[model samples]
Target chain A: MRLLKIIIKNYKLLDDNFSLEFIPKGRKNIEDKEFELNQIDDNLYTFATMAVIGKNASGKTTTLEALAIAYDILSNFKIKHSLNEIKNNNKTISLELYFYYNKYLYYYKTDLGYEPINDFVSFKNEELYNCFYYKSYSNDIFNLDKYSKIINNTVLPDDTSIIYTILNKITMRGLYYWSDFELSYDIDKIIEIYKTLDTNMLSVVVNLLDEHIKDIKRENNNKFMILYNDNTQEVKTKKELFSMLSSGTTKGLFLYIQIITAMLSGADVLVDEIEIHFQRTLIDNIINLFKDKSINKYHSTLIFSTHYPELLDLTSRTDNIIICKQNKKRIIVENMYDYNLRSDSIKSKKLYENYFNTAINYETLMNLKKELMQEIK
Target chain B: MKYLIMCEGPNEKAVVNLLLDNNLLIFNRNDLLGLDIYHARQLVPYLVNLINSYNCSNLKIIRIGDKFTDKLKIPESIKHIIDYKQILKCHTHPELEILLIIDKNLFDKFNKEKSKIKAKDFAKKHISLNGHLYDNTTQFWNDYFKNNIKNLVNDIKKCKKIGKNKKEEIYLADLLKK
Candidate 1:
């Protein structure tokens, strides 16, 4: 399943109507410089990176937050916390996420705001299937809604969401949604399919972990690598994913491996601040992997936010850019792909400059270096 | 050795104009950025890099920011840039200082507001720069407190905390004193 487009309305300064039309239907701009924009279908999300830029207090972060919340509304079935109880539950926060799976359009919308207006998943096909929305709360799936920048437009059907509904039933382990949520998903159905994956892609992840463990044990003799928590079942299982290694060395190496793992999982991956806790060079490496879409294995989608300006040289087009800026009262946010920019020239620097401007504090910079030089020599 | 002297605002402009009028300092307004709007902290890196980049050992850069501290913070990336010495937050109220101490006729010329010459002359008689002296740096309000220069300077120093936030109107005062 691939997200084709997203609509943000009255949520943050995205209060205005905005849509990121990834799959351009009936639109012809072959000159769009971006290969993703030239696609004819209304469902394929070909763009690998989404860079957000804006002045201070701009709706940049808010825009991503709204989309994350939208997925949370659909994926989780039961939640003690209502949509409004979540952060920034606007009186009418609604989203129409368009997903395109194998050339078919599926939409998932939720009125997490007020009055619960028409929150349903629908397809235009002759068969109308509406299994309850895929929610993030009160479900077994852990959807990191705020940080995930996914297109909800083309969400897959509930049955289609599980790798195999009937196969994974006998086994308790495989890909499960967030454990804290009470997911009614057929755990038994997915377990049988889990057996198909242990050696192929799963073993590769284990090798990466094993290699990391060897590297760590070679460097540091007795330090505990895989720290287990008795109170948390998920932690115990996830610790196996960690090699016997120091957190810092394992962190950057582990993250890139995780990116590969996510790609192998055949699921939409949402990573916020892909630049965080990683070296700039390592970030470039991860981004390079996503950019190579022709070699994509699992039919996965990658949506991420970053603040590194050196990142600009790595992107394909400004269409993948989303800017969120603050207005006098609210955050002004819109997707760069759909912004109807008058001239292409004014926008080329918009995305990176947005990141650069926030980080450009000259006064503190001067004193810090001045103090550091004194300490250095 | 080329030295740059920066003013906080337009009053600093006027005060420096007056100080130049009294033949005190040797610099001009064009030496600073217009509208006093460029960031105060960013100036540090530019200053630090300028000397080496241009291959000049005697290069200098100076700045005066009026409360830009509340919004712009200096970045930490260029922490080793050691190009120029900074004399920041220097002028107390360079403009108002001109008004408090400079001759009254010079103050009216740059005040931007107009009043009768007779009224201006009457105000001039009440204030004099002859006996004024700043115990450390003269206060902008010393004219009202002192019969001698020390009280005037002390009073001016007193206004720094209160009036430092205000734009200096000293250039106008210098014009009025003229």
Candidate 2:
């Protein structure tokens, strides 16, 4: 099911009064400064560019990790047990996800046992991060077990996207860009979205790799591995992420994976430290993966955090972006678009700082005006 | 009549061009730019973007050499490639297709002596390629493409993996030398 919306109550390392809103393109704005989840709808930004800006340890990684972990557990729980049992079905965690698949509304809540103890808190600790599905109040309006919207199978695997299941076209496309390298997946699960190729385009890609992959696999079974010095050495399946690639290479390929692999196979990624060790120009190159049209639409929505303000030009309204700032006692978030009051593509964040955070991005600086004047003159 | 294709090695590109030219598929100086294929991990995505940008509707993608079927543990969907298959499939090159020409001998080599080419030996061979790839990456593209001599094409109707994307990537570079 497509996760159109999610509302978080009292959670660890998060704002007690925090609720992140995902407003879909053309959907009514359901997000405000207040935190509440009364009516989740089709407009929530499930599949769009979502930027979470915050100070170091401002919960940017935590927020993403929580969501990633939740989804990872849920997708795996239906079949294989997770590495951590206690973490798998925790009773004290509270989270709720509101999503839509095939234009049908669905809500999944997990009572990870955060309920009775804290009188100040709601009722229980519940979570449903990777949990996305479609539900019909009337039951006659739509069917969750099987869908007819997308040409593919209606019933989706537990780990796939609820949106892909309902639409039966594409599913759980976790396009993750990392700001830090600490978080990433161990192995990639490839999926296909039956799209046509661009002729020489596929060959261009294959030309570069066809020979190398052959050599690597020829020496061994067709597995992903690393060739050490003189003897043979086999790496774990997910060697690319952990391998010692340059920051730019890692970032670039990760973005490429988010794009081509998204096209070749219907796989989503969980990237970490997207901006780490990357030059400004490299960072610019990496974001263009989203702009490319050949990518799978469902798998193209990326969820990552950044410390760079110049990267602001990559996104449009604040809806696609968020700023994580630390207030006196809690982490605060403000929309990059709404905070600036401008709806156009801007390098506003770059003007704010060599690094961009919401606090500095939205606020105007005197030096930038002087710089603008110098350029104008 | 202008089209460009990138391959990982001179031998791989030459094998395809030679076969194409021999079969009456005329290639001119302005018609294509042959890029020596490098790493599968990096090559595919870059070319896809280039194709999307140029807006070319008819382009021939010929990747040739050896089929290291053993190591190519790719999913069946991407396995076993054909010449110009990509160009044909995308309708970008409606009549065009993506063909991967590989050495038939290496298939047996990988099958027979796979253990001989220890992972470390394979890595060394990869590093030996550092000069070419590093020079290309560090140097400008125009200069890189210029200094690199065009590979000679010959006849190779017996090449293997003639219709797969994943297996096509394993073209045998040293096969011709052998």
Which has the greatest TM-score? 2
- lDDT tens string, model 2, A1-377? 34444555445556656655554333222121101111233223343345566666677775676556444433432212222322433344555655454444555554333122331112222222222333433222223344222233344433333333233342334444545433244123221110233434433432233222211221222234444435465654435423543444444434554556554543335445556765554444445444333233443445667766545555434466766667676665655545454433345544364333435433357778988999999
At residue A220, give the lDDT of candidate 2: 28
lDDT of 2 at A170: 28
Question: In model 1, which runs have C-alpha deviations exceeding 4 angstroms?
Answer: A10-14, A24-45, A73-92, A113-212, A215-258, A337-377, B1-178
DockQ, model 2, C-alpha based: 0.02
- Per-residue lDDT tens digits for candidate 1, residues B8-99, read 34434333443443333433333332211222233322222222233433433444433334322333333343242432344343334343
Q: Over the stretch A5-114, how does candidate 1's per-residue lDDT look in tens digits?
A: 56766665665565654432223232221222323233223455456655545555565555554334334421112344333454455556655444333455443333
Residue A315, model 1, lDDT? 46
Q: List TM-score per model, in order.
A: 0.41, 0.44
Q: Write down the DockQ of candidate 1.
A: 0.01
Q: How many steric overlaps are in each model, in order?
A: 83, 103
TM-score of chain B of 2: 0.31
Which 10 residues in a row give candidate 1 chain A its minimum summed lDDT? A171-180
